[model samples]
Target: MLQHIKMYGAIVLAMIFWAFSFIWTKIAIESFQPVTLVTLRLVIAVLLLYAYAKATKKFQYIKRADLKWFVLLAFFEPYMYYMGETYSLTMLNPTLVAVIVATIPLFAPLFAFLFLKEKISPVNILGIVVSLLGVMMVIYEPQVGVETGFWGIILVFVAVFSAVFYAITLRKISSHYKTVNIILYQSIIGLFFFVPTFFITDYATITDIKITYKSLEALLMLAIFASVLAFVLFAGVVRKIGIAKTNVFVNLIPVFTAVFSWLLLGQQLGFNQWIGIVVVVSGLFVSQLSRKRKISEKIEEITQVTEY
Candidate 1:
């Protein structure tokens, strides 16, 4: 129980860091182009992850056969995921964007069922339904007056799908490489993918950049907390609790994002958004209960065998 609490606490901290990501992106994008910002962030991420991998001797696990999976993961995650998210944030409000991205777990089961042929339990389906309603409530502004609302939503959905693929694909990846190796190689490859984009998108300005206090602070927080710590915590949770249980925590991200936006960015969440957060959190909780029940049943069966 204490360990579980610690896991959730880590997730809460991660969500707080992530909540600031919208504001950070908005600020960073003011001076840097989308691809350029992603490039620079990934470069920094690669350096940090590389250092971590070396410090822990994780690089030794990177066999030649694992290179393909690492490259593919980079394609799905930081490369495609961050790019789409960056593009979408430019078109929508940060709060709205966070709300939209919160539907990642809604699509996770669909991806699992489609690609892995994993059966979705009724509770999982219900969780998806409730979370979908929550997402709708959160993002259903009276007037989506932005010219690019449709495209922004589509891009956000793309980010969600890419994340789902990344999560489900991790099993295949782990068969080939260790987690730190995967993180390192993926960031390295992702950085290289953004290399040419930097040139095409005027990446030269990144060096000439004046690091204002606010921008530098935001960047440091993003690099340290959002990128490194969040990923490490996420990986640890996956190892501790399995993917399905760990993923339930993701639904809580929107709740934190909304709260943080209100506190940090002075954004207001109407009653409807609050209701949405409640519904989503409730659904995720139900999913956890259902999983627990299954585990308990298995334990009972083992006990019965031992008694007999």
Candidate 2:
């Protein structure tokens, strides 16, 4: 019972951290370009993860056969995912960004089954339709049309697709590698992707960066709490209780993002939008409903391998 308390607390904290990540990235981007901010966050997170892994003696040498898989993982995640998510924040509010990004797990399995031949239950399909309807509710209004720019939504979907692709790559990685080790290599390798893009896209604007205290604080919070700590916490819960139970907590991210956006960022949603939040979260919970043999096995493979 005590262990359950700890794990539940840890996962809840992880959700809070991830929820705030959208807010933090919004603030941090004020001082840094999207890619620049992501690159720096990755640098800080990689260093901290490496240090922690070393201190705990949990580091593992990468297997050569798995080398390409790690590269691909970084490409999908810290590279494409961050780029999509961060750039979208430039155009969209945190709550909106959170809603779209939250759709990842809901839709990843559909993509995986479509692309990778992974199996899923009929219920998963129904849940995805419900989730998409909820997402549309959050995104559109009868009078105003879509709530944000088309490109912004498209970018967030890029993050979503990257995560979907990462789910495929995740299976190839050797399970013996510690989670920290996997993240370490991912961050390290992800930098290679980000650094070049940063130089090309945002480096010229470096001189224009404002470097305010709030931005720096937000950046550090993103690195320590969002990128590193939340991931470890979520991963621990996944190992302890398995993905089915632990993943349900991820639905809390949008709710927390909405609350924090109101409390901290002063963003508000319309009544229907709030309803959409509930609906989407409900759909996420609905997505997890699985009883048959196929869903029980495939679900363990369908969801996230890591978080922000």
Candidate 3:
């Protein structure tokens, strides 16, 4: 029971940190370019994660054979995913961005089944349907002259796709490497990718620009809370309870993002948005619980048969 509770808490905290990312990226992007912000965040995060890994003596196991996969993971995640999201947030509202990014759970299973040949249970499909309903509710409201740009929405969709791809890729790569090594190498590779892009895109003008304390704080928060801590907790939970169970926690991200935006940014979500949150949460719980229950019952039946 206590172990289950800890798992649940870890999932919840992970979602909260992810939600906070929406808020932080919104602020930091106000002053910096998308790739520039990403570059800076990756640079700081790589340094920090390396230090943590070395101080704890966790950095020595990355084999040369695994380097290619790490670089590939970095390409999908921090480079493509972060760049897409950072650009989208600059163009869209935080809540809208959250809603779009939250669609990953709905889409990831499909990609996983297609690419990784991972099974998607019927319950998971139902959860995806319900979660999609919730996402639609959050974004659907008639307004005069409310223009959601097509390009921004497209960017967020791509971000979601990138994340889905990364999760599927992670399944294959995690088998060959420790999560720490995977993340450590990915961050380093991502930083490598980010540097040249930053130079070509924003470095020349960055010297003349003023860096606001608010932006610095937001970027730092993105590095520490969203990037470092969230990934660590997620890796730990995956190690403990397995990734199948750990994934359902992602459904809570949109909920926490909405709540935080309301409290901190004074953003108001409409009645329909609240309903969407409920639907999404319900679907996720039902989907995960149903699968677990079925597995437990199968185990019990096996035990009974053996006893007989």
Highest-scoring model, lDDT: 2
lDDT of each: 0.67, 0.82, 0.71
lDDT of 1 by residue, 1-308 (tens): 89878987876566566767777876776666778777777777678878887887777556776677777777777777887888887777677777667656555556666766766678778877887787677666666755588788888888777766666555555555666666667777888778877787666676777657776676666677777777777666666666555555565666676777777767777899789778767766665454543322222221111100
State how far residue 259 of model 3 sits from its true place (Å). 1.5
Candidates in descending TM-score order: 2, 3, 1
Task: Compare candidates 1 and 2 on lDDT and give the better one.
Answer: 2
lDDT of 2 by residue, 1-308 (tens): 89888989999999999999999999999898999899999999999999889898998889898888999999988798998999999888888789888878777667657776868677777778877887887876444335456678899999988877776667676455876888899899999999999889998888998899999999999999998889888888888888778778888899999999999988868898898888888888887776554422342443454646
Residue 14, candidate 1: how far off, in angstroms?
2.9
Model 2's alpha-carbon lDDT is 0.82
**What are the per-residue Cα lDDT tens digits for candidate 3 across 93-212?**
687788777656556556656765667778778977887787677666555124555677778888877776666556555656555666667778888888888898888888766679
